[model samples]
Each structure stands twice: as structure tokens, then as C-alpha cells.
Target: MNTTNNIVPAQVIALKKQRVILKTETNEVITVNVSKGKKKDKVFMLTMADLLRSGLWIPVNRTLRQLMRYDWLDTPVKSYAF
Candidate 1:
């Protein structure tokens, strides 16, 4: 039940009642809750939704801002702390 540590490729299936259902490569599915907010916030949410839909998951410790800064999504994680 602890799926947080599981590394699985997931794809978005549908959205209902503000939740996203992700179907993994193994056929396992998980639903993630999404928040409804203003248009500004929706931009960020949509980006996250796209990532999930593409079967990519971001680590909890990293922020979207950091990812945007280094283009790590298309590359690899680089240490920016120095």
C-alpha cells in the first residue's frame, strides 16, 4: 500500500471530481488528488498533470521551479546546491 517508494511508469486515464487516475506499466492504478484554483495556479497544476500523463513522476523533495531551472526533466538531476 506504500506506493510512494515504488518506481513505476504511470499514464493518466481520466479526471473526475478533481482527482487524477494513473495507470502504471504493470497495470496498477493510483489516484492523485488535484486542487482547483485560479488560472495562475492552474498553469502549474496543468504542468504536473502533463508529467503524470506522460508516465513521469517527480520526487517529492524537488520543486517544479527547480526542474524548470535546470531542464532536468529532459536531462538528469544535477546538484545546484553549492
Candidate 2:
């Protein structure tokens, strides 16, 4: 939410899910991991494109001070009333 910093988070692309393919900003495509996971074994299948577009790509450090700042809110569900 801070526009002062224009850095993207590493977590945006560092999730533990298998990547089907990777597309570079230059329009080059490559076959990458289908999912991202370290030796510990955890996988996430969430789509991160929206986050990337919003420029929230900054990586978050797992510190109590950082996590405690948030009150654990959820995004409102999108709707179509047409």
C-alpha cells in the first residue's frame, strides 16, 4: 500500500508450487517448476498475477513485529450483480 517503495516481494514468485511455465517481461517463455517447494515440503496453488499487478511483490520477513501489525483481515468476495 506504500507507493514510496517500488520494490517487489520475492514471496510473490517464491511460493511452493509447481510452475507450469515462466514468461519473462521481455516476452520470452520457459518451462519452469510446476510448483515451488523447498526440501521441507509445502505447496501453494494460488494465482499471484493480481498481486503482481498491484505491485505488492515485496517479500515479507517472518518477524513477529511484521506479522503482528496486521489484524488478519480477508479480502472481500467479488460479485457480479448484473
Candidate 3:
């Protein structure tokens, strides 16, 4: 079985302290941690590992495009282009 096929597409709806809220294409909402660290630090972008662990997947192309639109997110679009 291909695990990738089970991955669901979701959009970042809101950002909270060390957490990211996402709404799926099917209208399901999910909350995921931004970092695995202990400190209460700020996070700019979500990592591929974090998304996968949270059962979410945002395509690289869409991530790059959205990165531009969500300027508050710190990081170059090229980083997600991969």
C-alpha cells in the first residue's frame, strides 16, 4: 500500500503559540505542533515531518504559492519548493 495516497491536503487556517490550525479539503479541522522543542519560542514555517506526523500534507507547489501570500510566515518560498 502507498502511504502517500492516504495523505490529505489541508490549508493553514490559523497560527497560535507553537501550534498551527489547518482545515482540510473535506472540511476537517486539525491542530499541529510547530516545534518539538521545550522552549516557548516562535516558529515561522511548518516542517514536512511535522505535517506528516500530524496527518497532513500540503503539496510543495501549493506551499510555495501560499508562502508568498502568507507574508507573516518567515522563510523563502524556495525552501518549500522542494
Candidate 4:
């Protein structure tokens, strides 16, 4: 199954090693894979884990490199560039 697409699914996988199903507005559901350790030069994810350990899951709403920043497990994909 394709584990790429929605950011939420990736984030869920990043936070918890539990794969989840996310329904996109396009009426498509995607499945994600949650792996251990760091991949894709995962600096943010490593930091996120640290935050989680310190009981901090609220930073996900902030922007990257800002005072507080959180992002999906995978780097956000831009346009498909058809």
C-alpha cells in the first residue's frame, strides 16, 4: 500500500508507531507505515519525540523554524507537477 500523501497519517505514524487510515477530500483513503529510528534526515521527528517525552504535543500547530514548529513525519510534498 502507498504510504505517501496525507500529512496527518504520516504525523500519526511519526508520533506513534500505529498506522492509521486517513480519508482525503478526494475520496481516497491512504495507509501509512510507522517505522522506528530516524529516516529522511528526520531532525524534526527526533525533536518531536523529545518533545513528546517531555509531554509536548501542542507544538504541532506551529510553523517550522518558528518559536514552536511541528510537521508531518515526512517532509511535506509540494504540487504533483502533473
RMSD of each: 8.0, 10.2, 10.0, 12.3
Alpha carbon deviation, residue 42, candidate 2 (Å): 8.0
Candidate 1 lDDT tens digits, 1-82 = 5544454445566656666566656665666655565224665557666765675654321111122223544433364454
lDDT digits (tens) for residues 1-82 of candidate 4: 3422213211222344433223334434344333453434467556556644554323221111111223433445572244
Assess each prediction's global lDDT (C-alpha) against the native: 0.50, 0.31, 0.51, 0.36
| Residue 37 lDDT, candidate 1, scale 0-100 | 58
- Candidate 3 lDDT over 1-82, as tens digits, reads 5545345567667666666667668776666554555224323344433554666446322222222224323456777755
**Candidate 2 lDDT over residue span 1-82, tens digit each:** 5532322123233323344233334333333343234222322233344433443422232221121112211233354244
Among all candidates shown, the one with the greatest TM-score: 1
Query: Model 4 TM-score?
Result: 0.26
Per-candidate TM-scores read 0.44, 0.25, 0.43, 0.26
Write the number of the candidate with greater TM-score, choosing between 2 and 4.
Answer: 4
- 1 or 4, which is superior by lDDT? 1
Q: Could you tally the backbone clashes for each prediction?
A: 0, 13, 0, 0
**Candidate order by decreasing lDDT:** 3, 1, 4, 2
lDDT of 3 at 26: 76
Candidate 4 backbone clash number? 0
Full-model lDDT, candidate 1: 0.50
